[model samples]
Structure formats: C-alpha cells, structure tokens
Target: MASPRRRAAASPALAAFGRQFRRYRERAGLSQTRVAQRTGKTASFVSQIESGKKRCRREFVEIMDPELRAGGVLLGLYDDLNGDGQMGFPTWFDWPEIEIEADLLVTWQHTVVPGLLQIDGYARTFLSTDEAVLARLARQEILNRDVPAPTSLIALLSEHVLHHFVGSQKIMREQLEHVLAMSEVPHVTVQVVVNEDGMPAGNGGSFVLASMKDRSEVAYLETAVRGLTTDDPQDLAEIAHTLDKLRRNALPVGMSRSLIRKVMEEKWT
Candidate 1:
C-alpha cells in the first residue's frame, strides 16, 4: 500500500492535547493566569496552547504537567504530538487552518498541477487510489467554498509541467483543458515560468505560501521524508521572497495560457 499523503492541518493529537489541557486546568480551578504564573509564561501563552492556537512545547508541558497536577497525562500527549528530539511539524493536523481559511492562496507546483486545480482524473493518476484522491478533492473545495467566499488563488508552474505526461495523452489533454478553464475564473491566476537552456531557480522543490485574512501567513513544504508547515516570521519571509522571485520569472497571464494551449495541442495531441 502507498504511504498516506500528509495533509496540512492541526494534528488530531495536538487538538486532543489542547482539549485535555483545558479540562485539567478547569478541574484544578485555576485560570490561565495561574497556570502562566506557575510556568513563567504569559496568560496569553497558556490560553493559546490550551486552545490549540499554538503548539505546546515539551518544556512547557514539563513545567505545566507538574504544576497543573496532570500527573503524566499532559506530558504523554506532548510526547505523542512530538516524539523525541525530532523536528516538529509532521504531527500538526489543527489551529493554523492554513488552507481552508486562507483569503489568498499562492502555490508553486513544480511537478504537476496544484491540488486545488487538478481534475479528478489527473489527481487520481498519481494519487493512485480512491481515498487519496478524495482527500485532494476535498481540499479543492476550499477554493469553491460559499460561507467565507471562494478563495483567490495564484498558481505558478514550470513550463515543463504543462508538457509533462502524467497519464495517457487523453488524461493530459483533459487536465490541461481543466487548467485552462480554471485560469479563466475571476479570482484564479495561473502563470508558467519558462527558462531556456537552464532550470528555474526554484527547481530544488515546490512549496506553498498562504496569506491569511488576519494578515498573518503560513507556508507548507513537502520533502521526501515529511511535510513541514510553519508560521515562523523569518522562514515565512524567506519563502515569500522565493515566491516573489519565481513570480517575476513567470510568463504573463495571456502568454501562459497560450503556452498551455500550445503544449496541449502539440504534445498531448
């Protein structure tokens, strides 16, 4: 069986820790202030961790576990959320709500079409199973949601991606057509980057940066080993700069559409 693809969200374990921590605090009859005082953290920090707005670090759990009389329960959950000195990102499955709630989503897809724009056939081609394809499709609804209005997307792709064959020629043709139709949507802009006799600057990998309505930002990067989601100011700034450079090298909107059509007609056909 194929290993499950990682979806960007607050990990269920992390959310559970938040819920359990809230219960332990309330049962002890202590306010967030009391917990913060005992842990040498701010009341806001206590609230955010308990509410799942922020990740509860191991040290925070170490201090709060004894202070809150949680026995080993809170520490255990923290360990489950983040095991041993490893990098902390794979376990977050909540709170940032990066994809679904973003007012604007900017994605760089070096290999294939962005998930939000992929047709079911093209998506399933590599996803290779119903369950995984469904997950990708579900994420796609984020771009078409009604309650908070549809998300605006700016997708930057490599010229190579348009010509790459994901499946059969028929599937490739349909996928390009789908991309073209989506590009016509009022809020979706698709640009292709073309550099002759050389690879583009971002060829090292593809990643996504989401700008939230609250003026905060988050970024997601998928590596061969794991997926990383971060809101760290400095890291986000670096990814933003990288994205800006790629956009600068990308073809204009009209030229990009023409390229897509040209490739679909000449190569896929």
Candidate 2:
C-alpha cells in the first residue's frame, strides 16, 4: 500500500497554541495587562507570545502555569509548540507560499530542478505516485493564479540534472521541450551550472532566496532528510551570497538555452 501523502503547512501546533492561549485568557477574565502583571512580564511580551508572533521560553512556560491557574495545562501546551515550526510541512512542500508572494525568486538547483519550473512529466516522475501528482498540481496553481507575477524568476540548474532523465526518454524529451518553452516567458531566466567550471558554491546544498513583496527576503533549503525555512536577514544574506557565487560559475543565459536545446535534440533523435 502507498503511504498517504500530506499537504504542508507551518506548524499547526503553533497555530493551536495561539488559540489555546487566547481561549484560556478570555475564560479567566484576565485582561492582557493582568496576565503580564501577574507573570512579572511586559504587556507587549505577553501579547506577542499569545499571538504566536514569538516563541515561549522555559521561564515563560513556568510563569504561565502559576499565573493562568490551569495547573500546568498552559505549560504542556508550550511544550507542544517547542518544535521547529516547519516540521509541520511535508518533505519538500515549504516554498510555495513564499513563491506566491515573491518579487523575485533566485534559486540554485544542485540536484533536481526546483519543482515550479519542472515540466508536468518530470514532476510526475519525481513524485512516482498519484498522491504526489495531486500535491504537485496544487503547487502549480501558485504559479498559475493571476496574482501579480514575480518581477523576476531566475533558475540556475546543475548540468547533471539535464543529463539525467527522471522518467522515460519520451517524457524526458517532452520535459526538455517544455523547459525551452518556459524560457520564453519574459520574467523567467534559466541557466545551467556546467561541470567544466570548478564548483563555485562548493556543494553547500540547494537553496532558494525569495525576495518578498515587502522587499525582505526569505530563504528555503531542502535535503532528503528535511526542509528548513527562514526569513532571518543574516541567514538569507549568506545563502544569497553563495547562490551568487554559483550563478557566476553557471553558463550564460544564451549558452544554457543552447545546451537545453541540444539535449532535447539528442533525446528526440
């Protein structure tokens, strides 16, 4: 039997924690300031904690038990929220929302090409099951919706990804043709990282830097083991710097287009 596939969302646990906190507070008839004063914390801190805008500390959890009078229920809730938020998302399902709101999306694909730009057949091959096909199709809707499109969508794929076929030769050929067609989109830029050049990014792993509508950037990194999402400027800046170095080593846009064309020709022949 196939394992049930899952759609990813940020920790529903954190979301749950927020709901619980608000429910308990209102039930206790305690204003936000009352909770703060009782717990010896600031009103703003209490507000942020309840709203899931910030993480709770062990100290905060301890105070909540005595102040909320729920006999450690609130602390238990805090323990549930202790996990990394992205744990709620399935293996590679973390980037679509950021992509939806991106002003520009710069990606470096060390292994498979990022899913958004993959052809239908290639996506299906990577998934290899009906459930994943549905998930990928839903993700495709992010790009399809008539929302304001990203100002730029740059994809830098390793040459190895082009050389390998995820599915049958026919599917591969069709996929490559689809890629060529996608290259024609005015906002898209595709480049290949050839083996002829020394590795510039030095295998730090694959990552995406999405410049959001607010002009801030978020970064996502994925491996077979897990996925990580972060909007921290420092972390995103470092990843962006590495991707920049890799882009420098990648084939020029025109040459990369020719390479994709050549691969498609050889496949069809």
Name the candidate that leads on lDDT.
Answer: 1
Please provide TM-scores, in order, for all candidate models, with all chains considered together.
0.72, 0.66
Model 2 lDDT per residue over 179-227, tens place: 7787788878899887664545638888887765545556678767877
User: Looking at candidate 1, what is the lDDT of residue 251?
Assistant: 92
C-alpha positional error of residue 20 in candidate 2 after TM-score superposition, expressed in Å: 12
**Candidate 2: pairs in clash:** none
lDDT score, residue 110, model 1? Answer: 81
- How does model 2 fare in lDDT? 0.69
Error of 2 at 25 (Å): 14
Give the Å shift of residue 103 in candidate 2.
1.9
**Model 1 whole-model lDDT (C-alpha atoms):** 0.77
| RMSD to native, candidate 1 | 7.9
After superposition, which runs of candidate 2 have C-alpha atoms over 4 Å from their true positions? Answer: 1-94, 200-202
The 10-residue segment with the lowest total lDDT in model 2: 1-10
In candidate 1, what are the lDDT values of residues 1-269, reduced to their tens digit?
22322343443334446778988889888899988888888999887776556786678878878777899887876775567553244453442356776778888888888888888889888786899999888887776777889888999998878977887899899999999999999989999987764646676577887766655566788678867776655776677677767877899999999999999999998
